[model samples]
Target: MTIREHNGVGKVTWKAEPDAHDYPAAASYLSLIAPGAQAGDLVGQLQTASLEHYKAKDMLRASGLPLLPPDNPHVAADLAKVKNNKALSPVLLIRGDLTLGIALQIADGYHRVCASYHLDENTDIPCRIADHPGSRVSALAAAVGGDLVNDSR
Candidate 1:
């Protein structure tokens, strides 16, 4: 694999996708893209929770990221979409020492989770959790389309 540098950081090109369950381990290496971020071992664990809208709001607020009212057109639209179809993927979350003390910063599917929570205070949210210190977006972004190894297949 060719090693390339971006902004003075070297990374080995991934030739294939790692197992879906290995996200946490991969995230630790990927955190190099952003300083003060860390990803812990995968728990191989998941759970369903009925999170409240206010709680979701609080969760997002604690993330230290700009808060978008659940009623925002896009948020509302996504909420409606989720209400109509509850078959979407789980909400992805990340947590780590440097991350805000918020319960878990949303790594992916924030809008969808918000919508789910807004639609029903007791909405059943399936979340794939991880321990990571990267900014919410960066953590998930790397997994989806950044320099970190991914399931490109």
Candidate 2:
């Protein structure tokens, strides 16, 4: 468990890595935006990805997702876990495409992010982040000897 103190609420503890189930959960969510194989690839990368930390406020800003209310059942449950000193499972994410104006994908743990925000926006949440397959098109094109346009106009 890792601890970080905040002014409004007490310390929030986080697991060293994402829970084993988190990968499947992330794959399920990713499938909504990508094909099944791509989603699976993303999850595979997440499984081997290094752990990282980012502030709750920054994540919300990057994700462009509204904060779930503290009264929300899921968020409340996470809050209860914090109160009970139980560590939260790290989040899983897919890096956003700035060129495409795509927002960061919080594949799993949206509730936990909101819960952490309610406790303290500055809370540093642990996560495993993976790049979207679209971002790797350049490398794929290079290997296949194909040229693609950057149509981001």
Q: Which residue segments of model 1 deviate by more than 4 Å? A: 1-58, 61-67, 98-103, 133-153
lDDT of 1 by residue, 1-153 (tens): 122222322221221222254345334444553343323333322222222222445445545555567778867776554444323444555544344444455655566556644544334444454444335644665677744322321
Total clashes, candidate 1? Answer: 1
For residues 42-132, what per-residue lDDT tens digits would candidate 2 score against the true structure?
8987898777889999899999999999999999999999999899999998888777777899999999999999999988999888776
Span of ten consecutive residues with least summed lDDT in model 1 = 45-54
Question: Each model's TM-score?
Answer: 0.42, 0.87
Who wins the lDDT comparison? 2
Tell me which residue pairs clash in candidate 2.
Answer: none
Against the unseen true structure, what C-alpha lDDT does each candidate score? 0.44, 0.87
* Clash count, candidate 2: 0
